[model samples]
Target: MKQPTLPFWQVWNVSFGFLGVQLGFALQNANVSRVLSDLGADLHSLSLFWLAAPVMGLLVQPIVGAASDRTWNRLGRRKPFILGGAIAAALGMFLMPNASIFVAFLAPMIFGGMMLALMDGAFNVTMQPFRALVSDMVPNEQRTLGYSIQALLINIGAVIGSILPFVFTNVIGLDNTAPKGEVAQTVTWAFYVGGTALLGTVLWTCFRTKEYSPDDYNRYKNIAPKIVEKLSLTTKLANFWKLFINMPKTMRQLALVQFFSWFSLFIMWVYTGPAITQYIWGVEAKWFDAEFLHSVDVIPADIAAAKGAAGDWVGITFAAYSLFAAIFSVFIARIANRFGRKITYSLSLLAGGIGYISFMLFQNAEVVHVNLLLTEIDIPQGALNLLLPMVGVGIAWAAILAMPYAILSGSLPADKTGVYMGIFNFTIAAPQIVSGLVAGQILKYAFDNQAIYIIALAGVSMILGAIAVYFVQDNSDSTPDERAIQGH
Candidate 1:
């Protein structure tokens, strides 16, 4: 059976929804900490608050992927999930702003966060089919470009999400002075924009890029007979347990490396924002409730007074990291072409490790120069420390996105790409669950809010994840190049 190839522009149109989808995702990643803290939630307990993210993801992702794979309706296999997710994301955005108070130990913030988590899975569901759809719809020649276009859209969406709150506060005059660690009106509006875009962009793809009918699909596509027709939860958990039990020689070795790599990234994402705000902004988690009251009069001018020279550098530091990622995205495919997937991955992780190590050495206040330097800029030790590592982190991030999939997609059987990818993504999503549950406790109990040590752990994880890459062994049995590489 032969797969049909869509024209380049059509392929781009089908994958277009990811632009809006990532907008919501980038907003979730960049702002969740800021939002949680503003709503009077305890920063020390934030990792636990974030635990909702993985719980929902682990529970929802496989099921949604399985369900969508089986779905056949007028709206098509992928559309319902997107439409539903968009609706939920909009509601979560609106509800997030109201999360300032507790109704009997159930913080409105927690409730809203759970809603966002639910929305995350629904969005993720539509995502799988689109990837598989590319294989189903595209020939080999255009795939590299097809995926790159999707990546570009994703990055563009992320830039907007990352900067929206900044735009909202600086230009739109939405007060950044929400309660300590609470959601701001401007951030809330960004969500509204993100959600609306998420729904509409997907709707455009659903209508414009049509799926082949079952008979035509069967005529051209080499699909295996459906496995199980459906899988029970017990069965899925059984497979996850098999991650340890009866593990293959290849996979077991990989797991040890994955654990450390993920642990580092978990710490970096969960703690960076609040940690930056606290040590530099001098707004401790312990002072959150007091800062909430100051919302009536505590302006940016006031916060700037507290932080001294560090405040201005904070945004630039974040922008610097994103800029690195934007550039990294362009060269990634070339690196994959040159080094072979596993080797390229290992090298990227090593670079990130160096970046993380640089962070520890550079934390001295004397190390940072002013961006413009006309006024003799001396930023806070904390912000300067974080910015340096972000360069490496961006490189590490690019590898994480491209490598494992390249390995897995090569190996997975064509008949069951959806299920296998779902199972594989478990590593990525499940680690988030663990990180969220443990990061805050580690900060509060292990190090007593000495956030620098936690970030160092992330660097260690990169070194470890790099080590694991060697063990991964590139078991891409079904990859397009598999037969040629084996010289069979």
Candidate 2:
């Protein structure tokens, strides 16, 4: 039995919640390093602090995946988990930037780190079910389109989330710089807005999407309906171990690809703020040191202002890449169908590799003025050139969000889709965990504490990921006639 092709609107609704989820993530990625730095985290410890995100994913995703597989309630199988996770994530978003409020209990950086972990844990709980839902609902032929639509919504949310801080600071004239121990109002407001948006969008998806009943799911996926039995803890653990040991061949092959891809992404997220501020704005790393902050009543006015401006600009650069990814997602399904997923994914990662490598090439700090409609804004000359590289990163990001899942979904057993999808996240989480563990040391010893070289290193890793993609076997490849009919 084949799953019925959902209407385009239903397909669109299936992934609409991802928009809010990605919004929360984009804010985290674009600003967390800057937030931690402002809260007194040092340059050498940024990656360690960043470990909170992937670490949470490693711990949360599989458990949520397996639990959701057996969950069937009035709220629907995936929707309950999705709604619950979103509420928790929204709370985390509201609290993370305001960690300074809890300084009496713990240091601001420590509090912020704890909030980051909570937010990411909730994100993982929400994300894995969404991945499995697409596979469960969409027929084999529409898988690429389903995932591409998801990628599109994700990037759109990212674009908006990435730019909110900049919009608050630059357009609304919010106070971008605050005291040494406090976060800027611009960032604080962005989080408030993002948290609200996250709840609203996720609620839309939960209310609109109707999951298949157990019998219907079994019939559609061609699986025999077995008695629902509550397994003991030992049996559950044993089953999880068995699944891990015998993961699909495609999943195993894609692990290396995922490793390189996420390692590069982790580096970019952890270092981009410091890289842009120090490399372009010439802000010293020592300025953010905890001891230094403790000794001085207030940071020097110039350094504080420059750091604030640079942080805002970092948001713009991240938003640029997300915007590019959003644009690329529209045609990604057609591209994958035309050239094959392997070729499409490989070339995209190669482009992102080149983009990351090019970051070091533009170092000019001269200011440039650009008029937008009725207003003019000043931007760094070097920073303006940075958007060029983001184009490549954007293409790779869109493919990264869509292609692997499209390939892996075909190879999964019908009833086990949720567990396998959760298991696949290990590939994404492990590389990031490794990168977080060693990246700061690499920067300190090999790169002489220069964050820009770390960006270049990310480029190399992406190229390696591009090479590894060729080794994966794409079980979901379409025939020539199918491609022709799909307008590829």
Give the alpha carbon lDDT tens digit for every residue of 1-488 in model 1.
66666776798887788777777777776767666655545666767766666666666666665566566688776566656766676566556655655446676666656655665665565566666665545555555556656666666666666667656665666665554434567677877887788777877777787776656665665654444545688986786565435433444445555566666666665676655555555654544333444554543565633322232233345445555666676777666655566777788788787776666565443335545322344456666566667787777766666556555554445545555555555676677777777777777788777666666666777897887787676655324464344232
The segments of candidate 2 whose C-alpha lies over 4 angstroms from its true place after superposition are 372-375, 477-488
lDDT of 2: 0.90
Clash number by candidate, in order: 9, 0
Output the number of the lDDT-best candidate.
2
Highest TM-score scorer: 2
List TM-scores for all candidates, in order: 0.82, 0.97
lDDT of 2 by residue, 248-361 (tens): 999999999999999999999999988988898888767756777788987889898888888888888888899999899999888877777888999999999999999998
Residue 449, model 1, lDDT? 75
